[model samples]
Target: MSLELKDVEKKVGIDTHIHSTNLKLEKNTINILLGSTLAGKTTLMQIMAGLDKPTTGEIWFNGENVTGKEVQKRNCSMVYQQFINYPNFTVFENIASPLKITGVKSDEIKERVGKVAELLKLSAMLNKKPDELSGGQQQRTALARALVKDSDLILLDEPLANLDFKLREELREELPKLFEDRDCIVVYATTEPQDALMIGGNTATLLEGKVIQYGKTLDVYNKPENLTSARVFSDPPMNIAEINKNGETFKINNNNVQWKSNLKIKDGKYKIGIRPHNITTYKEGNNSVEINGKVLISELSGSESLIHFTNGKLNWVSLSNGIQSKNIGEETKLYMNIDEFLYFDQNNRLVNHG
Candidate 1:
């Protein structure tokens, strides 16, 4: 079944939590609600789940208006960031709770619970209590409960966020596969840009209670509508700085470095956006513009390194592959690929390279 919201807005006293927005979630597809905290992801989900009512606007499911309906009337299952389970109940009992509440036969409940447990690798600990399980196992139990319900709408609110890095990575890879054959709408909320990319889906990027951009994940990531959208979709944030454009020349850092491009535009001031990964230390001749900067911070993560560099008053970052041993206060050569630059107008709207 499909779910849709029309002109939905949420307000608390004088504060607006979710601005007027409209969205239609397609069936059998993963829809990613991508944004940082207080971006209205949870509020929106709550509205749809009937936990909170929208101050205005309507909600529709499969062409029927369900705005005033209760969550129990909609047949939806939700898994929250924290493990929501009965502390005194065994994992098997917790997974079987929903089915029992709906008065499903014991035989069918057993069959469904067993299949979901095996899928989540929770079969071995079905008899254990919540406190006896590890963090991952506890989360798997929550997921199993949700899956066993066989609800048409599934809302997962950062279910893997509480786990350790290695475990989160493992679950992120496993989640999409878990719902492969389900004919339902899955809405997954996350605060990380990498998480949205990791789970390939249509993404709705929210900012300050507004839906700034919504489209296929890669399209929105590669071509953000404006600076806010770009910042919301980018990790490490996109390096931004004011630049002067004159004829075919674009100058940065008071013209200490000049990049000449064939794109024609009005001579004025604008902001330039360059991704950290697009900036490298290797020199590739005229295709790249080289500049000198002092390293302010360098962080090594696995086989990659993130370097924060500053040139005078200007600060930027470079994400380099392999191990980097650059130290603080060290001078380094940074090359930015001119071809990869995204030019935005003074209003921070992506206008044109020409």
Candidate 2:
């Protein structure tokens, strides 16, 4: 019970929407496809579901080639960003529709539908039509439909993206448990970083039609393979600046910051990467790289704050705990841990993993 895509590529006229992709999705675990819109997450999922034909390569399910198979022949289910349910049918009927088509016993359909609806918190709306339910309820009904059917593969294409923050959070928390015991392959496609983090699964980070990185979610985030992978996995976008090695000192160009490095490299240009959270308010007794800057913008998101500032010409950002009190044009002191830095070469390849 596995899904494999080998050298799968999708082309729209002259434009290649998905590059040659090779992936092996294991069973009983959620595999997340994380990327921005137009990054080819949906395109890849569609190919896997038999909804779209690959321009090249093959799709294998459980070691059997399933390329060019019709959607009906595949034991798969899909949920999209928009809520999709049979508007004319009651929630219970919608959930049982798939089973009914397969000539499942009415008694079994009722049991499965009831159990899934309860898990998705749609038990109370069993008798209501989709039009009569709220947005969240309608989506839940669709999810229940998918869950009721014993599909070996489930594709969730940003199913929670259209919901409110509160509802999305609630569902995000429940989804892991919802599929825990199901011995199937679940692939969830999402653009939000926190959504992938909350789901706690293996992640395939896509960028511009290619899978930039694929591994355990935290492993990929903490150690992205390259600049493209790092950029796609980043939430606020990692701060990057050109740097040059000058004799014994490495200078961050465009900013008056210099540090001594022991790494043996040619005295040439490079790029330095640092995440926003790594930058913080300056503190004494810490072996921190200090910098002076003027605040440009300050935003409070719940208990945390994000501060954007500039050290003369080079702009930087810092994400700090608690609400940051600062005004635009105010002078501020910032610090970065000496060890919390990534150095990249001119080709955007990570050179140092400090």
| Candidate 1 lDDT tens digits, 256-330 | 877888766788898888888888777644689987889999998788889999986688888878877798999
Q: Write the per-residue lDDT of candidate 2 for residues 1-354, one digit (tens) a residue.
A: 899999999999999999999999998989999999999999999999999999999999999999999999999999999999887999999999999999999989888998998888888889999999888888888888888897999999999999998999888898999899998999999998888888988999999999988989887777777888888877787888888998868888876788776776778998888888888774523457787879999998778889999886788888887877899999988888767677778888877653
Best by TM-score: 1
Model 1 RMSD in angstroms? 1.7
Q: What is the lDDT of residue 140 in candidate 2?
A: 89
TM-score of each prediction: 0.95, 0.94
Residue clash pairs of candidate 1 = none
Evaluated against the true structure, the overall lDDT of model 1 is 0.89
Candidate lDDT values, in order: 0.89, 0.88
Candidate 1 lDDT for residue 225: 83
Q: Indicate which candidate wins on lDDT.
A: 1
Cα error, candidate 1, residue 12 (Å):
0.3
